[model samples]
Target: MPGDAARPHQASLPPAPRNGLVPSLERRRLQAYLLFVAMDGFILLASFSAIAAAYLGPGGDFAGVRQGAEPAFLLLPLFLTIALYNGTYSRAGLTDWRQAGAKAIAALAISAALLNFFAFFAKMNAEFSRVVFTAGIVLTGAVIVAMRRFLARRLTARWGRGAVNRLVIQAGGPKFSLPDSIHIDAREHGLRPDRADPASLNRLSQYLRNMDQIVVSSSRENRAAWAEVLKGTGLHGEVIDEATRAIGAVGVVKHDDIGMSSLLVSNGHLGLRARAMKRVFDLTISLAALIALSPVMMLTAAAIKLQDGGPIFFRQRRMGRGNGFFAIYKFRSMREDDSDGARSASRDDERITPVGRFIRRTSIDELPQLINVVKGDMSLVGPRPHALGSRAGEKLFWQVDRKYWQRHGLRPGITGLAQVRGFRGATDTEGDLSSRLDADLEYLNGWSLMRDVRILLRTVTVLVHERAF
Candidate 1:
C-alpha cells in the first residue's frame, strides 16, 4: 500500500489485572446492588413514616403501635422488585437526575397501586387513609430523589472519572482513525483519554509515563512491531482485536455474535401498541393545545406585527422523516430578511428583535407550532425540526451523520427532549448537535405519556431558568 509506511505504528497496552489489589468488578456490582437495596429501604421507611403522620397521626393509637412495620416489610420487597424490573439498578450509572427521579416516582406509584388494590380486594381499604397513602408516596419519592441526587453528586465526584478505563493510543497509519468513533465507543464504556497522541511514540511514552494503565487500538499485524518498539519502555503491551474492540469498548454486543445475542434477546423494537397510543395522545394533545393557545397565538401575531414589519407567522421548509420536506410553523421571532432565512439565529444576532428574544427565551414563539402538531406535521414531543438547509459550517443538519436523521423517524416535536435538556438554540458545534440527537434518541426509545408530561414540566422549569436562549 502506498500509505503503509505512513501508517503510524500503534500499540495497545491492556490494563493490568488488578485482581486482589483493587476493587473487583464483582465487588463494584455488589456495592451497587447494596446501594439500591439501602435506597429502597430508606424510601420504604419514609413512606411508612409519612403515611403514619398523615393517617395515624398524634390522635391515632396505631401511630405508635408498630402496625406499619408489617406493611413496610411487604412493600419494601415489592418496591425493590419493581425497581429492578424497571432496570433502575442496572442503569444507575447511565441515569441522569431527571431519569432517576422519574423512575423512582414510577416505581413508587406502581407499588402504591398494588398495595391499594390488595387492600381494596381484602376489604381493608378503610384501614388506611387515602390522603396518607398519597402523601406517603409523594414524600417518599421526594426524599428518595433528593437522596439519589446527593449520592449521585458524591459518586460522580469520587468515582465517575476514576472508574473509567484509561487508554492511550499510538497511531501508526497514513490516516488516523476518526476520533468521533473512538470517543463515542469510549463514552459508552466510561473509558476516556487522559491525553491522546497522533504522532510519535515518544509522545505516547511521555503521556503514559505517569499513568498506570493504557490500551492501544491498532491493526493486529502491527502489534508485534509496536511491542518490539517499546520492549524496554517498562510498559506492558497487548493487542486489541479491532472487531471485538469496538463492541467491548462500547459494552454493546455485536448482533452477529452469539455471545451477545444470548445475553440481550429481549432487545425489541418499541412496541406497536405504544406507538399507536403515542400517536393518539399526540393528536389529542396537539388539538387541545392549538385550541387553548389560539388566543395567545393571535396576541403574539399582533405583537410581532406591531414590533417588526415582518410576517406574523414564520414558516420554513424543514426536513422531516424520509427526507420529506414540510413547512414548520413558528411565530416570527426574527426579521424578514435573507440572513434570517439563510442562517440560524445566534445569541446577540442583529436579526432578533427585542420581542423575538423574549418569545424565543420563553418558548412562547413555539406555541404556534401546535398548529403544525395538530396538522400532523409534528408532535408535542420528539426531535426538534430543523430547516432543510440548516447546517454547521459545511455540514447540513441531515448530512452530518446517519443518526442525525434517525431522530426524524418520529414526528418532529414542538418541545423535544433536546429542548428541555437545554440543547436548544444554535448548534454551532458537532458536540452540541450530537448531544441534541442523543437526547432525541433517548426520548424515542423511552417515550411514554408520563415522560411527555415530565418533559413539559421540565420545559417550564428550563424556561424559568432562562440559562439557554
Candidate 2:
C-alpha cells in the first residue's frame, strides 16, 4: 500500500490477475534492506553472546531467557529507534567509519543510561552485573559499526560503477549533441550520461521517473527553461552550468582565474580547526616517529655507504604544501648518477644497487622522510609529493587533466592512502596518477586522527606482507 502510488502505470496493465504490482514492489533494493535488517539482528545476537561470555562468568547460560525476554525485546526496538533518530540510515550520513563508530557508541551510551535508569526505577539493577551491560554496549556498538562499514563498502564498490542505474541527459545546443558528446565526455569522469532527444521529453520523463536519481545540465541562459520543463514533468532535477558541468564531470578543476573562484565558493574547503588539528597531528607524530626510528635511519645510511661509494642519502626537490619546493629525504636507493630528470623508478631499475633494491622493496628507503616530517616540510599522512617536470615524456601523462598541484594543499607525506593502496610505484600514465590523486582527495576530504591511525596500521600490515614498493 505504501509504494502502490509510486508504481508507474501498473494499474492500467492487467497484473498477473492475482497480485497487482506486489511482485514489483519486492525489488532488489527492498530485499537488500531486509538483508541489512537480518544482518543487524545477527550482529546484536552475536555481540550479546560475546559480551555475556566476557563478563557473565563464562558459564552463565541464558537460563533466565524467558525472565529477560521482555527486556531484551524492548531493548532491541528501542535501540533501532534511537539509531533511526540519529540518521544512521540516511544517505550522506554515515560515509566515514569514524563517524559511524562514534554514532554507534553514542547510541549505545544513551541506551545504556536509559536502560539503567529504568532498571533502577523498577528495582532490578541488582539482578544483572553492570559490567555485563557495559561489555554488551561496547561489543554490540562495535559489531554494528563494523557491519555498517562492510555493507557501505560493498554497496559503494558495486554501485559506484554504472551498474545499478543509467543516467539520461537531454542537452540541446550548438556546441553539444544529445548523447554522443555526453557519452564521450562523461566516460572520462567515470559517468555515462546517455543522451535523449528534447523532442522525446515524455520518454525522458518516464526514464527519470524510474531511475534512482536524475541530474540536468544546461547553459546558464537555458537552465531556467530546462528546469521548468523538467518540473512540469513532475521530476526533480539539478541544473548545473553546462561549462562547469562539462569540466567537473571530467574530474579536472583548473586553478586559474575562474577555477580558483569556483573552488573558493565550493564545499571543498576544510575549516580552520580541521587544518590546525591536522598540522598538530603531523608535527606530533612525525617528531615521535623520527625519535623512535633514529637508529634505523643510522643503520640504513651505513648500509647505503657500505654497499656503494655514493651519497648515503638522496635529496630531491619536490613540491610540498602550497606549491613550496622542499628537498625530500630518502636513503639513497639508487646510484647518484642514475638520476635522469624526474623519471619514476621501475621494479627492476638497473641503477638500483642490490642493497638499495631490498630497502626500496621493504620501504626502508623512505625512513629518512621522518626527518622531513619533523622539519615541517611533510606530514605523516598526506598526498605523496612528485618531482618537478615529472611528466615530460608520456602522452597519457600529458593529458592528466587534474589539479595536480592541488595536492599541495597539505604537506607531502611519508606514506598515504594511495601509497598503502599499491598505487605507489611507476605512475607512467595519466590513469595511474589520476587514480592515485583520487585516493589522495578521498583522504583529504575525510581526514581524522582515527583514520590516520588506521592507515598506519594498514601500512604496517602491507609492509609485513610486502604488498608494495
Candidate 3:
C-alpha cells in the first residue's frame, strides 16, 4: 500500500487525446505549457531578427538606432505572462484555433502598448528606430498567432477522424447518451449508483484506472463508500442525487448556467479577484527572489554537480492546480540512482549525499521551485506541492482526511501556514496530516496580503525543522 500507484484514469467529455493531434516531437508524451511559451518566443524573436536584418542589411545600422534589441527579451516575457492570464496557454483556450488566435493577438498588442508606455515615461522611446520596432513586432505577433492556430487545427482535426474520449458509466438513474466525441461503456444495465454494494464499487474502482470522469450517486449508504473509494485515487467525481432529473446538462444547455435539473456540483474555491491577486503576488515575489538568489543557487548547483558527478536537479512529477499534472524541480539531495523518490526520507536515510543533506536542511534544495512559482505552477505562500505517490507511514495523504483536497482549492506553495506553524515533516499517522490541514484551512479562510507576508516572514524559522531529513 505504501508504494501503490494512483488511479482515476483521466477521461474528459470527449475521448482522451488522439495520437495524430500531437506533433512528432510531442507524440505520446504530454508537453508542458512552458514549452509553448519557449517555442512562441523563439518564433517571435526569429521573425523580428529577419525583419531587422532585411531593413538594416548586413551592416550594423541597428546598433546606433536601438543598441541591439534589448527591449525584445524583456517584452517577450511580459507578453507571455500576459498571454498566460489571457488563457492563451490554457488547454480549453487552445482547443479553438480562432479563439486562440484572437487571445494571442490581443495579449501581444497589450504587451506592446505597455512596453511603449514605459518607454515613453522613461523618455527612451527615441533610442529605437520606430519603423523597425513597429514592423517587427506586428509581423511577429501575427506569425506567432497564425502558427498556434495551425497547431490548433492539427490537434482538433484528429477528433474529426472519430477519435474521441471514452467514458465508463455505472450510473442507472436514466440512460444518458453523449455525442460521438464520447463513447460510453455502460457495462451494468440496471446498476443504481446510489445502491451500489461494496463488491460492485470495488469492481468499479479496479476499472477506474482506465476510465474517465467517474460519477457516483449520492445515497445515504453510498456517500461515504464513494468518498473512500475515490479518495487518494486522483479521480474527481460528482455526487449524483436521485432527485436529479438529468445526470449532466444535455442539449441546449446555456453557457455556464447552473440549471435546476443539472447535476453539476460546486466546491467553492478562490474567487476571480483573489486568483488575480495571487498570480500578481507570485510573479512579483518570484522575480525578486530570482534576482536576489542567483548566486546562492549557482553555488548550490555546483556543489551538487561536484558531489557525485550526477545531475544537479532532481525532477519529480507532482499534482498541480485544477488536478493537472506538472513536473517540479528540486536540488538533487539523494543518490543519483536512488530507487525510491516517492517515499519520505527518514532521519537517518543513507541515500542522502553530504551536499544533499546540507542543502535540504538549509531549504536551498527548494530554491529551484522559484521557477515553478514564476511559471504559475505554484504560489509563494500556500500549500506545498506533493509528489504523486507521497504517503504517510503506510497511507496516502488523501486517505488521512476527507478535507485533504479542500486545501488544494488554491495553488500549492513553497511555504504555507502549516510550515510556519511548525507542522513540517513526515506524517506517521492520520492525525499528523489532519493537523496540517487544520492550519491550511485556517489560512484559506483568513487569507490576506499581510497574512501572506507574515507567513513568509515566519517561514524562515521552520527552514531547519526536524522533518528535514
Query: Each model's TM-score?
Result: 0.43, 0.44, 0.52
Total clashes for model 2: 0
Error of 1 at 239 (Å): 33
- Lowest-scoring 10 consecutive residues by lDDT in candidate 1? 258-267
lDDT of 1 by residue, 301-356 (tens): 88898985678887776655322456888787877544224477777788788888
lDDT of 2 by residue, 1-469 (tens): 1110122443453222222111221144445545655666566656665555655455556764333333444467666667657745443322444555566567667776778788889998787656556666666777888887877676656444221332334343223222211212221222112111111232233333333333444344444444433322322234444344423332322323222211111122243345557778878877787788888888888888887668998887765654445788878877754232456676667778888888887888888888887787788888888765466237333136334534555667878999788776776667788888789778866778788878877888665324333
- Judged by TM-score relative to the true structure, which candidate is superior, 2 or 3? 3
**Top model number, lDDT:** 3
Clashes of each: 8, 0, 7
Q: Candidate 3, residues 358-383: lDDT per residue as tens digits? A: 98888999999999998877889987
- By lDDT, the candidates rank as 3, 1, 2
Off by over 4 Å in 3: 1-172, 175-238, 242-265, 336-342
List the lowest-lDDT window of 10 residues for candidate 3.
20-29
Lowest summed lDDT window (length 10), candidate 2? 190-199
Name the better of 1 and 3 by TM-score: 3
Off by over 4 Å in 2: 1-269, 337-341, 396-398, 464-469
